[model samples]
Target: MNATQFKQALTHVNLLDIRTPREWDDFNLGGFHVSLDTLLERIDEISKEKNWVIICYNGTQSLIAMRLLKAKGFTHIDHLEGGLEAYLSL
Candidate 1:
């Protein structure tokens, strides 16, 4: 998403980095950092009121994250279309 769109969406949604911790340290995203593997374990700690946007290096991991969240019954999970590439390009 573009910077403007991201900012606008932030009012309703939260960004989530689903990559591994190594990946997170290599390039951190500006929101909640939850590794895909750990997210399921921490589902109860997530806020249902806030929408979630999954992000990763190239969008693949985000898609996986989205599917996983959905399986857990997360109602407002979204993913960056092109992951960080799209955000940085904007």
Candidate 2:
């Protein structure tokens, strides 16, 4: 999605940033914060119904994170289509 679409989605969904700790310290915006490693371990603990929007430095890792969440039966999962770095560019 483009920036406008992403912003609209985040208005209704929980936006997540699943980057490395170091990467996040450099820059992060949004509430849901889970490193990729941690998310892998706690995927099942997240609420299945809450709208979850996974993000990473780029979109690649978020896709992986999204897949992991989906494997846990999270039906309301979403992702920042272009991730945070892309958001910054916008």
Candidate 3:
């Protein structure tokens, strides 16, 4: 999803930020913070009930994380189209 859509869905979907901890500490939209590298190992911490919106620096890692979650049986998954940079551009 685009930044606009992401804002609209904020209350309805859970946000999964896959950026590095340093990136998150520098700036964040607030939700769950999980680095892409450790995502699979920490999958147990994520809930499958709520909708999810994955985000990364430029959408690459988020797209990858989205695919991984889907393969793990997560059905409602979405990702920032161009990532935080795009969102910031808005």
TM-score of 1: 0.79
Best by TM-score: 3
- Model 1 residue 26 CA deviation in Å: 2.5
lDDT of 1 by residue, 62-90 (tens): 88888888887788778877777777776
Answer with 1 or 3, whichever has the higher lDDT: 3
**Candidate 2 residue spans exceeding 4 A from truth:** none
* Model 1 misplacement above 4 A: 1-12
lDDT of each: 0.78, 0.78, 0.92
Query: Which candidate model has the greater TM-score, 1 or 2?
Result: 2
Provide the clashing-pair count of each candidate structure. Answer: 0, 0, 0
Pairs of residues at least 3 apart in sequence or in different chains that clash in candidate 1: none
State the displacement of the C-alpha of residue 55, model 3, in Å, after optimal TM-score superposition: 0.7
In candidate 2, what residue range of length 10 has the lowest lDDT sum?
Answer: 1-10
Candidate 3 per-residue C-alpha lDDT over 1-90 given as tens digits, one digit per residue, 9 for 90 to 100? 998887677788889999999999999999999999999999999999878999999999999999999999999889999999888887
lDDT of 3 at 6: 78
